[model samples]
Target chain A: MPRDGTATRTRILDAAEHLVIENGYAATSVDQVLSRSGSSKGAFFHHFSSKQQLARALVDRYVEGDLAQLEGSLEATAHLTDPAERAVAIVRHFEDLGDEIMAAQSNCLYVAVLTERQLVDDGTSDEIVRAVETWRVRIAEVLKEALAATGAHDVDADALADHLFVTFEGAYLLCRSTGDSRHMRTQLATFRRLLQSLLGPTT
Target chain B: MPRDGTATRTRILDAAEHLVIENGYAATSVDQVLSRSGSSKGAFFHHFSSKQQLARALVDRYVEGDLAQLEGSLEATAHLTDPAERAVAIVRHFEDLGDEIMAAQSNCLYVAVLTERQLVDDGTSDEIVRAVETWRVRIAEVLKEALAATGAHDVDADALADHLFVTFEGAYLLCRSTGDSRHMRTQLATFRRLLQSLLGPTT
Candidate 1:
């Protein structure tokens, strides 16, 4: 793809994601996305064959960006050899995400997309499921490493990872509905405490 | 409300709610609702002046029904004078709700409604916020009683209540996305364990 072509593609995807989050996928039309992106119909057609294709691209971009961010956060703590410290670092990264969510005017795009997945095609829905699984596995790897480093014998890393992921989503819903970031902060703190307790004295 | 008239109104509301959950607030049209409901345009107009009105009524009905169910669950455990028992009973009630959510084969109405609230009116959004607060306060009261009973002064009843609420919403999201109810069961179990740990030995 040419540079401008890539730029236009990104612009269109950005507009679609924003509109989908604001008005929902079913209500957001291609025309609206074009209008919002200030791109011509020809450009959109050149980039994506159809609205469904556009949706798929949007989710793909979302997942890629999400994973990249998670990897970047983990990489920031790569120098730390201790698993417990790395685990704490992971929690800290999520806390930063919670802050970003609170500061952002809208709810998470993945959440909106997931809620409206019934209206979307199976490919799109499968992408979302895979995205979630990918997140779970990535987080679990760090937690498992932390457990190994700490010599913790009793903890279930997979279950704990799922618990953390679910709680984070729950906190997002609460924060979005209540229009209060304090709840998110408190929930993160509680999870941090739980982790600390489980790990036993975060050295 | 006359008997037949009330029945018609309920029929319309039920259809609207179902459509909204399956689709979304923005995508679900009055026409679709009418067609599914087998109700006439005149009846829809008579029951609700506009689509917005119908949406409002749907949310109002959801909140009312939700509060009633919650109160009923709390009342069921009213006989338990011990605060710890009451707290545990409350968790069990939520577990039952998790079961109901799983069995429903769709996401929670409130979750859908809240996600779509940004597209709805401010009044609708405020109603959702209030409904969430009502749930939190009611659950917190029970947790507070348990804290007092057990002399467990360390736990913040309000925060814990919010956690439970957030976790429930998150669990709903997870279950809806994965098409699996086991994640919800696990989240609930983790919450129960947290409560047990805080309350100290469920006796």
Candidate 2:
């Protein structure tokens, strides 16, 4: 009887994500992933050709989930015609997501990659950059739309978008280092408040 | 004539800091530090008991310099009697610091330590937390003073202070990952703008 290759692959990825988040990519070894997942060396290799490949797979999967959440928020907010409301709603949506992540007590894979960029291969590194760029571009788009809708003339949508992203990354780091989950909530809320004030009252 | 042991220790630390910032603490070896600094294993062991000790020393040195800069900024802005102007000046001071960091093409050691927290010893880790707490408390003090002086009643000074720190950590991570120095300047500027808007015209 043949075993489920997909199940094995999922186990490896789950374990790898946890380890990478806990120990970072450089310190997380394939053997550790195998032992944690209870998968054999053969199963590990069957799923991932190399540690670098495993890293790539993990990043791709994370990117998929991340972008899905972003799209989900966009779809959920698509009904609102007001760009400002849509933008705020989208941020609130992520705030809710932050709540879920805090409840889960998981750190971000991207932060791990960002700090351990030189340890991973070029292709995997490029994916990290590409994924963050996608985020930057998407958030900037909505903000640009919101700024125009509000007739705001003094704000830079791009910079504000970067600020939002920066807050998420920074707050996550603080939360991880301090083990305070509310750090994320407070930081995101403050960003939202500042953003609202910058954009003025939603018209 | 005995060589200057202090000079040797400084060389090791300088090389270690660069490697840790570039490759992370776990991936960087004592041998690599020795090779980079042109110091022998005997010299390395003479200065530091272990890699963990080196990590602790690195963080201590970093924290000392970090707090010095913070104090230096506070001192330079001490002449501004108005709390609101003082707060704004403090933030502007950090924005200028961001510009300097970008120009130098360096990243934060605390961020590297945060991501590699598990690999470092408890004492080193505690120092990292303590250093950041000092920052949080100090900034919160100024922000609280500013808030009271501004007659603002709705703001949470502590949360706002955390926002500033979070922006620095997050913006630095993004800059490292993307190799875009402008990200820091733009993020810090936007933060300063939002903070000013929150504090209300700095009267």
Candidate 3:
């Protein structure tokens, strides 16, 4: 069994995530979180000083988890010398990420917060922005490497990387509006093909 | 000058739209709208029955305005018989749309509402969903015509249309997050090129 402190924190976060996604952040109350998490008021205050701090922690934890997943995918493809193959692997990882989001039946938490960014504190908004910028830079580096390996000198790797991330964001929005996963799947396939087209013939 | 009734309604919507986008739906109150719009309680109630009704009217007006803009672009391109040219014209129209959105300095209200869909009622949610579906169908019809004209029968016009809409949504999200219009401009260019690549060289 998990330690008491760790268990309480996880429970609080789980309840917060569900509630925040289910209701707007402004409408969600500390009382609701405490009741949903089944934690004492003292315990709740012990872990988080305020709701804003809790939000910041939630965003930070989500970013860490996402970056770790990305790192694992990159490492798994490290042995491959072909940059195009590595890039394709990274794209596949994103597809898997989409699948996971669909399975969870939740909009991206970062996106959820971003939509209501005006209502969030400046610190929380800054953290979310930085996390997105980090993702773009990391993916751009991968695309740059792939472009170098494939001799696809005409393509702008930075722009392409931004496109990749933006398209995913768009795909997620479509899925949420339509109640369909096919939107994401089809867009990702189109993106994969677009990436593949930038490569020279497979050796 | 516009009629008093027409003028008052527009004033109220302008105020509510600004507040809703600046703050959020839950946070923006009827009192705030009335204060911002400089309309009396009787005038406001005469036009909108409730906050929900005001939101619905705002969304409906926005959608109608958008569809009119799209129709104007399509009409401008009606003389171009070449499918590729027509497709490219449609894309250019979207680029202009991005520019307009950036100039306005507001995220799409539909998207803003979509992010907070869980907090809203079914009627509001249904209206948002229907607006998006309308865009998809209209764009798909254009793509279908293009495909038929070019004999690019292999392309899935429906999926491609959905991609176009999804990319726009994504680009808007990026711009909102980064506070940079360049993000939308670059992604729209990439999408335009993607559409061009689907066509054979201009005959």
Best-matching candidate per lDDT? 2
First chain TM-score for all predictions? 0.86, 0.92, 0.87
**Retained true contacts (fraction), each candidate:** 0.49, 0.74, 0.44
Winner of 1 and 2 under DockQ: 2
TM-score of each: 0.88, 0.94, 0.90
Q: Over the stretch A1-203, how does candidate 3's per-residue lDDT look in tens digits?
A: 35999989999998988777666666678899999999999999989999888887788887787678767878887887777787877777677666666676546675667667553447676765676677778877888887888776766777787777677778877877777766776787667655664554362
Q: What are the candidates' individual DockQ scores?
A: 0.48, 0.69, 0.53
DockQ of 2: 0.69
* Winning model by DockQ: 2
lDDT of 1 at B185: 65
The deviation in Å at residue A76 for candidate 1 is: 3.8
TM-score of 1: 0.88
* Cα lDDT tens digits for candidate 1, A1-203: 78999999999998998887666677789999999999999999999999888888888887787778767877887887888777777777676666665675455666677666454446576766776787788778888877787665555676677776677778867776776766776787666655664565553
Interface RMSDs of all predictions?
Answer: 2.4, 1.7, 2.3
